[model samples]
Target: MVQSERAKMADGEWYACLDDDLGALRGVAADAVFEHNTLPPRQRGNLGPALRALLGGVGEGARIEAPFHCAYGFNIFLGPGTFLNAGCIILDTAPVRLGKGTLLGPNVQIYCAEHHKEAAGRQAGLEIARPVTIGDNACIGGSAVILGGVSIGEGAIVGAGALVTHDVAAHTTVVGNPARVVSRG
Candidate 1:
């Protein structure tokens, strides 16, 4: 979890900040790219417009494929040569940064915002933000769900369907639920 004093401010206070308030200020800015479909296609290629529109503010060399979804565009920053495949959903209520050459497989879900688990907080429908960082050349496999405030180090490979809830070291191979490293860097 993020222990920095800057990360712990209340939601109301945070939403008042310029950087953190973009999602609320521009809710669904890419709606033109996200058209309603009774049954959305399972394959990729339907996401190009959405990706382009979302990354309009980021660097020019960044690449994001179709069949992806994100909560807000500003909260995500992609380095050059980064690629996200089909069925990727990023709840980027907080910052989600992918380093250069980072590759994400199909069905990858990266979440930077999490709701409180406490009974009172849950009932109140409160959520908090944390950052997710994927280092250079990391490969996240299909159907993995990465939780808040976790970092995948450089050259790490996360196996398919893994649920990563903690930090992964550089060049490690992590698989299964909660994602234990099978090979050390």
Candidate 2:
């Protein structure tokens, strides 16, 4: 059976990123993002209605500060009391789950898409997506980059400027490129 590009993407299979249907979906997400980004803080509150409606799930008291961006809002799920500071970007081509009370500092980037390595496939806009999961009460410092398929354990601390490419164990503090375990917090 032939699956839609989005279906393929959600199933973690290779898909065409430039597909028309996917483009329309992204456009819808962009509109919601626009509503969140343009509205004044006072008017916007934490998560605006449009943006909230667009997301897959947003738990009670969860707040996403504006100047935020995402490839598709529907793929993101935020737990209750989770706080995402300003300038956070999520490429939610796949599901991105942030557990309750998780805090992401400003300018944090979460990437869910991995492009094809071959030049021909890359030019064709081929790519695969993987889910990113951050456990409850975790703290991710500013400017950290969390790559796809990485699962951050509960209460884990990711240091600023760290590049996370693998799973981070619970209660561990990881710093530096490749995110080595510096301490067990």
Candidate 3:
């Protein structure tokens, strides 16, 4: 049976992060990420078998370039033809779903956890998991950061270096910190 902390994490509930079970899960992800990162370029097409096996789901043609990092691979799902460029990082404490044809440029970061606000709770390692979803054909530009609980609708575009903290409507283009909608296709 999975530990209570892990079960709570998977359920998207607030849980203490100091548990041994959670650390073990993170260690597994670290090993996989390390293997993928150190693999020869020619042998690491799409994703290395070790890394691929750790993920929850990988659709046909989905690819994540080397130097990719994730906290918990089992919570990530990539739809068909989705691509993540080099230096991408995903803290998948909760589910992170990337839809078909979605593209993430270099250095993109996706976070799925929010730490406790109070100092005492933070000291206690309390955190809550929130799912992040990117719909089909969306593009997240280089150096962008997608915060937990944010959803980007189909065909949305997030400009380079943007910080997204809110939902982005379908066919819209957003830029800048806090991600203001600049245009809609």
- Index of the highest-lDDT prediction: 2
Better of 2 and 3 by TM-score: 2
Rank by lDDT (best first):
2, 3, 1
Please give the clash total of every predicted structure, in order: 2, 0, 0
Candidate 3: residue 42 Cα off by (Å): 1.0
- TM-score, prediction 3: 0.97
Query: In candidate 2, what are the lDDT values of residues 63-94, reduced to their tens digit?
Result: 99989999989999999999999999999999
C-alpha TM-scores of all predictions: 0.76, 0.98, 0.97
Give the distance in Å from residue 32's predicted Cα in candidate 2 to where it truly belongs. 0.5
Model 1 per-residue lDDT tens digits across residues 1-185: 64332244223122222343443434564462364121244432333454455653444455555556777666688877787876788877677889888889998999876776677765654567778999999999999999988999999999999999999999999999989989987
Which 10 successive residues of model 1 have the least lDDT summed?
A: 9-18
| Model 1 misplaced stretches (Cα beyond 4 Å) | 1-26, 30-53, 56-61
How far residue 120's Cα lies from its native spot in candidate 3, in Å, is 0.8
lDDT by residue (1-185, candidate 3, tens digit) is: 64599889888888998889899999999999999999998898899888899999999999999899999899999999999999999999999999999999999999998999999999999999999999999999999999999999999999999999999999999999988999987
Model 2 lDDT, residue 100, Cα: 95
Top-TM-score structure, candidate number: 2
Report the error of model 2 at residue 107, Å: 0.4
